[model samples]
Target chain A: MTVSVDEIGNLFARREGTQRDAAPVLIGSHLDTQPEGGRFDGVYGVLAALELVRALNDADIATGKPIEIVSWTNEEGARFTPAMLGSAVFTGVTSLEEALAKQDAQGITLADALAQSGYRGTRAVRFQAVDSYFEAHIEQGPVLEANGTTIGVVTGGQAIRWLDVTVTGVAAHAGTTPMPYRKDAYFAAAQMALELEKIAERRAPRALVTIGQASIANASRNTIAGKVAFTVDLRHHDDNEVDAMERDLRAAFASAAKTRGVEVSIETYWRSPATPFAPSCVALVAQAVDALGYSNERIVSGAGHDAIHLARYCPTAMVFIPCVDGLSHNEAEDALPEDVTRGANVLLNAVLARAGVAATLNAK
Target chain B: MTVSVDEIGNLFARREGTQRDAAPVLIGSHLDTQPEGGRFDGVYGVLAALELVRALNDADIATGKPIEIVSWTNEEGARFTPAMLGSAVFTGVTSLEEALAKQDAQGITLADALAQSGYRGTRAVRFQAVDSYFEAHIEQGPVLEANGTTIGVVTGGQAIRWLDVTVTGVAAHAGTTPMPYRKDAYFAAAQMALELEKIAERRAPRALVTIGQASIANASRNTIAGKVAFTVDLRHHDDNEVDAMERDLRAAFASAAKTRGVEVSIETYWRSPATPFAPSCVALVAQAVDALGYSNERIVSGAGHDAIHLARYCPTAMVFIPCVDGLSHNEAEDALPEDVTRGANVLLNAVLARAGVAATLNAK
Candidate 1:
């Protein structure tokens, strides 16, 4: 089945070129979002793709292959998880059963959600078959806003790490169990998080640490925590930095265990090393953005993307457009229509330049 | 029925005090624990009272009233909700019907548990009738450990603020949800904890923020957390610090809500400001500790105590000794028998100094 941006009126065109050697540069973005989220986040990227395609046609230029556009299903996972339901299927990191078998807060499964939405597609974007993947998105942070950069030519994406660390203690009444006599796991975890932040900040400009998930067992206002479990998400552009942070994290945790006289165990959920971008794609985009008179910056992406997933099997590159306050994924997420079009022009020009298409567009 | 250390002995005991404030200072502590808990935690404080009673008798001092030593039924609440189950019942915070109605992990209610153990006493110390209250316990942290001080002669008990903060975000697939598009509650809560720690630490020494209880709405290894809720225990020895910390905590949370594009609601469980000991109670303990050749350094108690609850009705004082490695409520919870004895001796000497006692050989 062919894809199309119904709302933006952008047509999803298939690459006429050979799948790999004469591969068509794939362009797409997530189309779903958080329920109360900003409309511009996912929508902007989709519209940008449409604008890029329209500009290519306007120039009356064609490549050896056709570029495919995508609207990844459940990109927001608003209804269920393992989001990017369509793209994950395309990448094959997860199976269809795992992706579609998810249940929402109300126990509605993703398969049912997809069926109800009337947008479930049958075809997939096989990665081994694609030449390169590209996507445009909001910076999601204040970096682009503070720096006034218009176009970001991503050098690479940061490594991602997920962990669940549990420290178990004895639960007792808070009032009756003398503090000196109580093993309080919650206190130790809190102190560790505070100290861990320092470890990240000291290595800042690159290092980032987040305790994204936390919980305590047998928790009550009047009771000492019996067990505390939390997930720590630590990331950086460098693998060594990520490793060092993890090591330091373990040390801090062990020390806390010793101090609190509690037992601790850490479970790793996912680990991906920092992935390098398609070098030639990055160079081409850098060249194109400079030619287009938009300040091009070789930025390291803080947020992970589908391009990273595609990088495993094929060449991958990412496009970043300035977002207002660098806001994203919220109802307040916004970027001027002008900046978006400017970004589309850069994306269009960059793709054309890379794919050897002599194209021009009135993006401005 | 009259209560004694031996009648409740093994079941629970107070190390007994030599003197009793006419309506004997209703000294209390829990007798049960989660199987792995430390021994000296709840046990030692009660022993301190028993020992105090013993010392007063040895000195042939008599106060005008009958002294009662109590080992409350199931103060640990390991199998139930509040560790101070007896005290809660005594203070009317929980009715005997309610206390008895509650069930343990094994589905045994307090009444059933007590009935099975055959230790429910017909007599309960009238909380309002006590002349004054004094409890000697081990200081749970390095405040005394790092200081080489033998006593945490508390001038005031730290104020406690409990809050349950919930972050609402879209639960999506971990692999597919673009970091910016997913409003992960776990990530949001973790960041919130880190920031809360920062705000507290910035306030320093006084703003003690500990996240003691936490939970995710639905837990999964791969799910982008749909919702997460955690308990924040913010404390300080100063009332203003409590207010300031609460404000900073809420403000930091607001920023997280805005940044993460999620809804955040904080439910306050309780807010108790720094409670000072009655000056007379503080002075008596300070003098007694110094006279007994223990360090007279008066410090604030980091953990809440029965004295805090008792402070509501009667003048109360807390005498603290050091726990080995500042550890408590764990199998690893080891305190020198000598320290336990010394704590009791201090309590003995202190109570004798306060209420005056008749002949006794009271240390249980």
Candidate 2:
């Protein structure tokens, strides 16, 4: 076994295979967690990978391909933005220099933190040849627990789009302005928010919309709102459907503004296309869940994960165990021990399925 | 004429009457303006009273009853809250001690400010007697200008009601939470705002409603809103109508909250009843407008004023001229010079009509 830390602080433990020249099967997840996050979110996945290696060593099992356990850096983006920085750099989605230069709220760069921790290694940041990748993580949602499922074979991540909407009107005294004479920006924004909900409702179970932030400029209890700004988060499993939702959102906002005699401007600040895991990898995860006799369902990841980046370069899939109440990024986030163990077992079997056992081991 | 300053900083310029024992006719307004206010607003009313006195002097006219021009203090409430403090105290609506104890944002008490400015005289703050009260000021609205009228004979002040609404729900990840599983507070608040508009619309041209301030708790662009707080301002000429509107607002908000699976609480924090000016005083202003051959219309004061308090104890009416774009309490607030002069002329005639000219001046 050999241990190494990549330039971007991704920790890796490698066990040589019977056929050493073959590409390694990678089992990876992030170790970093949100600032106020619970104990089991990111660390559970990293420790699960470590546990898989320990179990294989105890059985003296050998595979045709080498197996590598990786713990990626800065997956939460709590201290630094643009989460999954380690995976993003490893997949070449973001440059090594850019990831290193990312700064936290205190203005400390990722490079500075890595160097201070003595984990900034000389090894290359980018991934080389990989046979397949598998990850185990908490579901961070209510679906699995609500449906009484123990394991989730995650096939993909939902597409997400963020919009900034600004509504402009004329401020006037709340007492002096008659109903017909007002161009109330907050009222127009409220209408747009309701319209966003309707658009999401039309698409039913798969579509989601949120108006998480809203504010009136120069807010006063006795003055009509002159300007209002709010953020819209829209998500769906299909990119085309999310695009359709965005169109509906924009049109509805424009119509509401027109009705209120106000002006509206929408900016699509960030967008991430839907990510679909490889079919063979997904099938392997499902096969593992079935072989283990665990109650499971094929689910799409609603939140971003390191696996999404790996899926771009290699056949990849995920195993999800439900956290209690679907709470993450919070201090109270929790998952049942039995569910966690079941998820880890599924991940181990999925990786083994992708990297075949040695002929000698099969004969034994 | 002799000038005097009262303990609460109200300034009075008194002209001896032909019948000295008769109650004096009072023409008064505030001299203070909003922090960011333009040149006119409060100062226009104060100077118009002075102009009326000068015009009578120029015409060598004397009145049977004594006449007084007054300038009230802290009417803008920019520095101290509960506006129209001086008049409120003078008319016994608010105690002088309470008015003196009011503090500015800088923590300076009104009493301290008056003392520092040498305007806190030994005279009592309360008004003893007055034949009638009149004020000339900017309309602070678009109505008069839109109608191309020269004067607005303000008949009464509107009833006003302020409400604080809070919507509470459960916050969840925007991406992970499906629409059916979520309780979004902002969406609920938005629905309530639209309902407020609908209620106002039902009451038509006279009723006014505004959601002037709104905010989500712990706002994040990618998290479902858990709580929202907002202010509702409702106004109408009739107190009964305003009360009815409040009921409508509460019912609509509760319905919307129930529909969204959220909890809503509404607090009627403040209310001011409708005030009707003395019929004889309103008639006097109308007669003056007609005698002066000025284009005019009857108007309800949609905003608060010192005159509202004075009407409790005296026959009170107001004369208003159009301001530019209905702008007030802002640096850009403006009024045409001719409109200002015409408003002052109407005020002069109204005061004279109430406090009849002496037989000697009538003969002249």
Candidate 3:
């Protein structure tokens, strides 16, 4: 096994295959997590990948294709704008120069950060042929645990749309302004938020909506809110459904503004289309779960992962184990030890299935 | 005319009475205004009082009781808190020591500010006997403008209550959390805001409710809101009604939180009871408006004023004129020239009716 770090700061641990010329099977996830994130989020995936390699070594297994465990950089984007910088660059989805130029809040470029952290390497930051990629991560959601499942065979990543909404009214004295005359912006925004929830509910199990960031401009306890700005996050497994949800969101916000006699503007600031994992890779994960006799379900990744970028260039899929309360990007994020081990086992078998075992020795 | 400033920085201009020892009729308002306030709000009242003295001098009229035009310090609390500090101290509602100790955002005490501005005086800050108190100012509301009335005989300052409300829930991934499982704090807060508006509407025309300040804790565009804090401002003419409104507010908020599976807490941070003006003073202003034959209506001062404190110890009334769109405490606040003149005329006659004219000479 040899360890190396790519120029884009992706850490790779490679185990040579018996048939060295064959393309390697990659198994890993990101290492970076949010500032306030729980330890299990991105770390779980990376550690699980490392554990898979250790388990294979203990079994004295050799494969036809080499296996590389990778830990991608800046997956959380907590300190930068674009996330999954390492994977995006590795897959040619984002150029190395572009990723390196991305700056954090303090204006420190990714290149500067990599150099300062002693992680920048001379290895090329571009994609090469790979047999397949498998990632093991804590299922940062309640679906698996609520269903009493141990393994999630992730088929794809969900479609996501981000919106910036502004509601404008007129500021006046809270005491002086009568109800009939007020065009309160916060009130309009509140109504719009509820409407967004209703829209998501209509689409049920698959649709998700969040009004996460909100603020009243020039807020004062004795003055009416004149302007309010908020962020809306909408997600669905299907691109078409997400698009429809966006339409519903805009229409509902417009109606709410009209009813309140305020002006509303909706801007779709970002969009990430649903990423469908390679059928063969997904099948491998499903087969592994079934062969292991673990309680399992087919699911879509609700949050973005390094595999989303990898899926565009190579066959890729993910294995998920439930975290406590479906919480992530929070300090309280937790996963059961048994479930974590089960997820790593799934990843090991899935990678072995894709990489085709060439020889096996007696267990150490 | 003699000009002097009190230790509390209240500016006073005295017009000697024919009978030297009679208690003076005091007429004026504050000179302080909000940071973003219009030129008219506090300045209008002070200038109107000065205008009354000029008009009386133009007609060479002498009253039995001396008249004093006063401009109170820090009436807006835009610089120092506990608004109407000068009058509060004068009326003994607040001590001079307390007023001086109040500080601005920069930690500069009111005493320091007065000293720096060379306005603080050796004269005592406490109030003395007076025939009556009269103030003329912009209506700071839409009522007079909406009704096309020229004069507003202010009956009293409105009852005011401020509440801080917090809603708590669990934070989860926006994309992963199902609608049924999300106890979204922002959604619950939004519902509570709408409910507050509904509650106020049930009490109609006189009742006013505002969710002036609101914020979600640890807000993220893609994370379910875990907690939300907001301020509610409730006002009415009757103190009992305002108290009832508070009860309705608490019940509604609790219900909304319960419906959303969140926890809610409401705290009444501040309360200022209704200060009804003396009926005799109110009638004097009404009589003056009628004698001038300008369209008039009896209205309550929706916003606080120096007169509220004075009403507690002396006969106090405020004369109001329409400001454009009922706007004040904003750069765009405006009032018509004719309305300003009309308001001052009402002030003049109201003061004359309260302090009897002892002598009159032919108009130069």
User: Which candidate gets the maximum TM-score versus the true structure?
Assistant: 3
Give me the displacement of residue B301 in model 1, in angstroms. 13
Report the C-alpha lDDT of model 3 over B68-119, residue by residue, as the tens digit. 9999988998878878889999899998898899989999998899999999
Tell me the docking grade of candidate 3: high
List the RMSD of every prediction in angstroms. Answer: 9.4, 2.8, 1.5
Docking class of 2: medium
Best by DockQ: 3
Task: Locate the minimum summed-lDDT window of 10 residues in model 3 chain A.
Answer: A355-364
**lDDT per residue as tens, model 2, B265-343:** 9998899999999999999889988998999999999899999999998889999999999999899999998998999
TM-score of the first chain alone, every candidate: 0.89, 0.96, 0.96
Per-residue error for B78 in candidate 2, Å, reads 2.4
Go through the candidates in order and give each one's C-alpha lDDT: 0.68, 0.89, 0.90
- Alpha carbon deviation, residue B311, candidate 1 (Å): 9.5
Query: Could you tell me every candidate's TM-score relative to the true structure?
Result: 0.60, 0.93, 0.98
Q: Tens-digit lDDT track for model 2 on A1-364?
A: 7999999999889987888799998897887887778888778888898888787776667877899999899988888889889999999999999999999898989999999999998789885898888989999889999999999989899899999999999999988777778898988898898898899889998999998999999898889999999999999999999999999988999998888899999999899999999999999999999999999998999888999999998988999999899888899999998988888899888888788777444433
Deviating ranges (above 4 Å) for candidate 1: A1-12, A15-22, A124-128, A176-180, A358-364, B1-364
> Candidates sorted by TM-score, descending order?
3, 2, 1
